[model samples]
Target: MEKGTFQDVNAQVVQRCREGDNRAQYELYKLYSKAMFNVSMRITNDYAESEDVLQEAFISAFKNLHSYKAEASFGSWLKRIVINASVNAVRKRRSELVPLEDRIAGDIPDEEYDDDTEWQVEQVRRAIQRLPDGYRVVLSLYLLEGFDHAEIGEVLGISESTSKSQYSRARKKLLEIMKDTHSMA
Candidate 1:
């Protein structure tokens, strides 16, 4: 769990974890837990449930370490596990996902820019959290996780076009919310 242990997750660490090295497994968990917690909390909106999802994700990742190839970055592989854990947690709670039909196309007006931008990072994060589940997941996967539309489609089991469309709508809605808040201020 120390910083040096996670400085690099090279082939050695992967091999060790694959061979069931407990320290390597713990190192991997500590390396990615914070990022996974943020992702899970954004999806689940419940701190305790998000913590559960984070633990579940690490357990699943460790158990399946043998299947991991070096083709994708370890962070990316772990992200898939975390996202899946969040989605599964939501499904288990039976929280109805916001329907796709609610994201119809429309012209989203542009927001005004200022040299002295006063928006805080926390405000933007809160705005993102306010987005519906469908849009929030797509937005986080694309903008935050750096997943392309096709990769996102594959992960979410949606068509590529659907991923593109969802991303566009999510951006539009997020902009709308930010602008409204700016106006209020």
Candidate 2:
């Protein structure tokens, strides 16, 4: 993710957006929509909702373009908006947020995770999509989005300990899913 480059490269484009240039808005949207849509999809696990989230995120970004202080890369800034919007969409669809299940069974050795089982991206992606919302979001944020435990905690409104435990469970669940899929295949 050449994210930092966008801060330097997209400066002119962002300025035009701030000044109400429709073409600039379009350009920004064009540049970000696919990646942002993927972010939405990972959270919502529904195509139409991801599309809706992407559109809403772009509109919000354009409307609030002035608030983008250029402290972070434009892509980073936009990604944060997309992530929040996607999470909100998921929350709305589920009547209630499923807080991460905190029960870790004993005797599940940590050494199991260290085994080198090769995994394809698509294989893991399908597995992730099948996870429950709480696990999927935590897993995606920590692994794919490069969010640390503290950042994930902040984003999901949980403590850092909760975030770490949630990620651990999510990783275990993801591996189980992959193994099941492989065995079935």
RMSD (CA, Å), each prediction: 7.2, 8.1
The global C-alpha lDDT for each of the candidates, from Candidate 1 onward, is 0.77, 0.82
Regions of model 1 farther than 4 Å from truth: 1-9, 93-119
| Count of clashing residue pairs in every prediction | 0, 0
In the range 1-185, model 2's lDDT, one tens digit per residue, is 58656565589899988888899998888888899998888787777888999999999999898899988888899999999998887777666544323211231232323334433655676678778888889888988889999998988889999999999999899889989999997
Cα deviation in Å at residue 22, candidate 2? 0.5
What TM-score does each of the candidates earn?
Answer: 0.75, 0.82
Candidate topping TM-score: 2
Per-residue lDDT over 1-185 for candidate 1, one digit per residue giving the tens place of the 0 to 100 score: 86645435556777888888899787777777898898887776667888999988888888888788867778878888988888777666645554423332231334554534444665587678667777888888888878899988887789999999998999999999889887998
Clashing pairs in 2: none
